[model samples]
Target: MSTIYKSEAGGREIQRLYREALDTWPVPAEHLRLPTREGETFVVASGPRNAPPVLLLHGSGANTTMWRDDIPSWSRKFRTYAVDLIGEPGLSAPSRPPLNSDALALWLDDVLDGLGITSAAIVATSLGGWVAVDYAVRRPERVTRLAVLCPGGLGRQTTGWIVKALLLRPFGRWGLRHSARAATGLESPESGPVLDSVVATFMHFNPRTERLPVFPDEALRGLTMPVLVIVGGRDAMFDSHETARRVRQCVPHATVNLLPEVGHAILGQTEPVAEFLRG
Candidate 1:
């Protein structure tokens, strides 16, 4: 079995489910695999051929499936590329390079180049948010606009949930389900399928444990493009308040929204994010 999964059978099961999800993608999409320095990257491209490009990046432990709910609306207005981040639980390669190095940005450069895109608007969440910000900082001229959801780097990473999850692990499936809900903040009945997917993925997927390297204020200050940040007040993974504050303090012109009732997983903002990307 690959080190990224618990066992060979578990990995195969997860891949089977991912394939099923891709087959039912909400819109017509072209599944493209690009050769990058990191490895082969998988992307789901949709919408008009002539529309402006909008890149979508999902958080860690996730793939393009996370964008299914938002794709229909956004794709109508723009050519959208939902990229499966390298090393995550997706069809992409399992090469996880050091986050602190310039490798990720360079890898993104290759992705954009391979797609024939010079610049594009980016909407990213969680770990993907960190990546978007990092790329924007390193290649500000290439990012027309940026919107991040519960992104890391700016906030203080929280670990209380880790202890809670570990304590509940002894309870088995019940514990795992509860842990998924707590971590994702998806407790509504409508989110049952998503929660179930999360549980199934975590059963085999090994998530990254290293803390994200924080972007210095000097780096953030260089983002001249329009920026939007949305974080949940009750986020279990990072301090949302600090993230909001840092965005305001460092990128003074950027928009910041902190939803009091949400958690690490911020959903149902397809319109808001699409509007921002449109502008």
Candidate 2:
């Protein structure tokens, strides 16, 4: 077991649960493992093989399961590949290449090549959004369309939630649930199962602590592809207003959505994002 988890038992549990989630995937899918320099990459492929390709990247500490709610809708129109980011709590290898280096971009290049793709649309969230933006900036021609949600690297990241989460850590499961709620804004009774899964994961998972390198205005301006950025105004993580302003000013042609009531986790964007990807 990789040291990304607190212990071997915890690692086993996380994998078991992930497998269970995979078993319950709502659509017909093919699980594939692609060899890359970063390590073995895991992808769940769905939709018609001949349809246009759409790459799905999940946020930090998450796996392809993050797209489960949206895949059914997205796969209907396009071939969707939900990639389990390396180093996250997923089936992928635990190879965490430095974010400041070009390693991740190269890893993604290997991923695209392995998928037999020359160009594809990308839908990513949070850390995955950072990955997509980095790749677009480095290899703009390979990305057909770009859509991101609450991604890092545009606005300054906040540590207030980190302090809050740390202070509440010793209180056990209740504390963890509150911490999850504080970060994600999923507080209703209906969000219990979601919160429970988050708590369960954090019980073992060790999330990356490095501050994501912020992209310069020059880098943001290099995104000439069709772009869409969706962020939460009340996000406890990144400064969404700054993110929105920068995207508007830099990528003037980009579509930006700022949801005032939402937080770091932006939910129910399946149809909106689908429309953007369709275009």
Candidate 3:
């Protein structure tokens, strides 16, 4: 889980590969720009039109480019579609998105209806994970499997000061849009084209921390997918161990993996995540 891509050149290589892969990502015949009740355009970008789909939801304040790290590996197994959550950021239109979980779920449903995706395996990170649980709790039939990475919305009350400071505070959002990229080992700014992509993620996807649902434990407890729960042993944003414990207790059937060394940064946890995707 803690493999290092040492040297600026090494990191740049990954970025180079990513840019090339995206250039030829093969957009579907007719991509849809679904209109959510909130009046936003949820952009859906995907692979081959007919393959069984996998939905990739990026973390809060980040765009689909964050998936630039995992897409090559993922798009191989499942026809993947990375969506820009309505109202949160990216190319999605409406400035104000729904802060409530129920409305968020409706937005997702609209996205699926517009895309013609009846069912899929969802892979979500942090805030994205929160929405996935909300959807599983509401419309389990639409999702066949779920994989969440160090998800959020467990209990904001139990959250550590670091995460609360970064995600909960406005400054935290700015730091990532301006800072945290390097802390996540995306140091090759010129190589990976980090500045532009990361800034776009911040501008378009960053959520207003005050807007999303709070303390989402009840909805998670009601989820019914073949859930694969993952957490970094060193995660400081949310309690990784507590998250694993509570999720196991809530779902009973969920598979949990407590990875060593890695923290809230999922981009660097590529190998283990690659295997997790395969699993």
Give the alpha-carbon lDDT of every model: 0.94, 0.93, 0.63
Q: Which rank order by lDDT, best down to worst? A: 1, 2, 3
Q: For residue 9, what is the lDDT in candidate 2?
A: 92
TM-score of each: 0.98, 0.98, 0.72
Cα-based lDDT at residue 173, candidate 1: 82
TM-score (C-alpha, index-matched) for candidate 1:
0.98
- Could you give candidate 3's per-residue lDDT for residues 1-279 as a string of tens digits? 001222445444444544454465544323346766656554445555566688878766555666766666666656777876554434555344454637877878887877777888888887788788778778899988888887876533234434533663466546654444433334444435655555533332323545335445676776777788887776656667888878877888888888766656655555655566566
**How do the residues 1-279 of candidate 2 rate in per-residue lDDT, one tens digit apiece?**
556888989999999999999999999999999999989999999999999999999998889988999999999989999999999999999999999999999999999999999999999999999999999999999999999999999999998998999999999988988888998878777767777888899989999899999999999999999999999989999999999999999999999999999889888899999999889
Off by over 4 Å in 2: none
For residues 94-149, could you state the per-residue lDDT of candidate 1 as single tens digits? 88889999999999999999999999999999999999999999999999999999
Question: How many residue pairs clash in model 3?
Answer: 5
Model 1 misses residue 198 by how many Å?
0.6
- Between candidates 1 and 3, name the one with more favorable lDDT: 1
Per candidate, the number of residue pairs that clash is: 0, 0, 5
